[model samples]
Target: MDVRTGLFYLFSVVLLFAAFRVITARNPVYAALYLVLTFFRASGIWLLLRAEFPAITLVLVYVGAVMVLFLFVVMMLDIDVDALRAGFWKHFPIAASVGALIALEMAAVLMGGFRASEEPRALPGVAAAAQAGVQFSNTKELGKLLYSEYLYPLEIAAVLLLVAIIAAIALTLRHRKDSKQFDPAQAVRVRASDRLQVIKVAPTRPAAPPAAPDTPAAETK
Candidate 1:
């Protein structure tokens, strides 16, 4: 086996392990961290396949941004692992069956890849483009297909993800007795006049009042 095949196997194994841990880890923070590992491994696999765009995107977008955000949120929230695991065993059998079904489907797909004919039928456009001495680029082809054929589905997926992010933010906005909230509406409405008041008062005389006008002072006078 060559270095590339060895690297592929290494990354694949690690990726599968990380993915399993992501689902089964008791600690949410650990689960999220494992997910980051999974992304890294998957990115390595993409790199091995000469898919630079997807590899970089997986590393930069998921591992760098999304998974980091997940880790931060998981850590900050201090979620109870025990509570999360409370009914896990009760649900495990069903989850396991579903997992098995997915695994079998994946196995079928992978086996079919091995059974594919050594020669693939060629498309005229791709063949003509190749013959024209244009540099072969999977990334360019991916971009073309994504923007043309899969554009609508890609856009819908993006909108769904945006909605999910908004929903998570909304969920985290639960009223906390210790949390302080600043209403932008109230803040914007507050004027400098309301924030500060300046009152002018007549200066008091340095001398004491004239012995209260009467009493002992009037008698002495």
Candidate 2:
């Protein structure tokens, strides 16, 4: 096999192994790390397809932002491994059934690969267009579809994501007694006198000597 084909197989094998580990690993952190490895392998496959934009986007978005956030959450949270696994056997039958169904669906989808025809090469006119200084890019085609045909769908997706973000914030938010909140309107309306206080006091003075009774003074003398 050629170098490209060899690399593709190599990446695909590693990607599958990593993906399996992500599901089967005992440690959550290890599973997350394996997932990161899977993303990297997928990016490599994208690069092999000459889709630079998708490869870079996978690295920057999933590996950089989403995976880091996941890792941070996993590490920072307290999780009980034994307690988590205690009910695994109880849930395994259903989980396995669902997993099998998904696997079958994926297999059915991928089976089409054996029958799908290869994409035709560029037409003579298209080749001439390339020679005439028109740059060819899959990213350009993707951008055109995203902006023109998929624009409304994309906007709706963005709005849904935004709503989901707001909902998550609302759900996870706790009203902690220790957390002090400020009123912006009250702060803006405050004057110097309202913010600052001054206390007045008398100047320092020496204590007066106590006067003794007349009989006690005579006895001292």
State each model's CA lDDT, in order: 0.87, 0.91
Residue-level lDDT for 158 in candidate 2: 99
Candidate 1: segments with Cα more than 4 A from true spot? 116-134, 144-221
For 1-90, candidate 2 gives per-residue lDDT tens digits of 999999999999999999999988999999999999999999999999878899999999999999999999999999988898999999
After best superposition, candidate 1 residue 78: deviation in angstroms?
2.6
Clashes in model 2: which pairs? none
The TM-score leader among the candidates is: 2
Best by lDDT: 2
lDDT string, candidate 1, 26-53, tens digits? 7788888899989999989998977789
Candidate 2 lowest-lDDT run of ten: 118-127
Steric clashes per prediction:
0, 0
- For all predictions, the C-alpha RMSD in Å is 9.6, 8.0
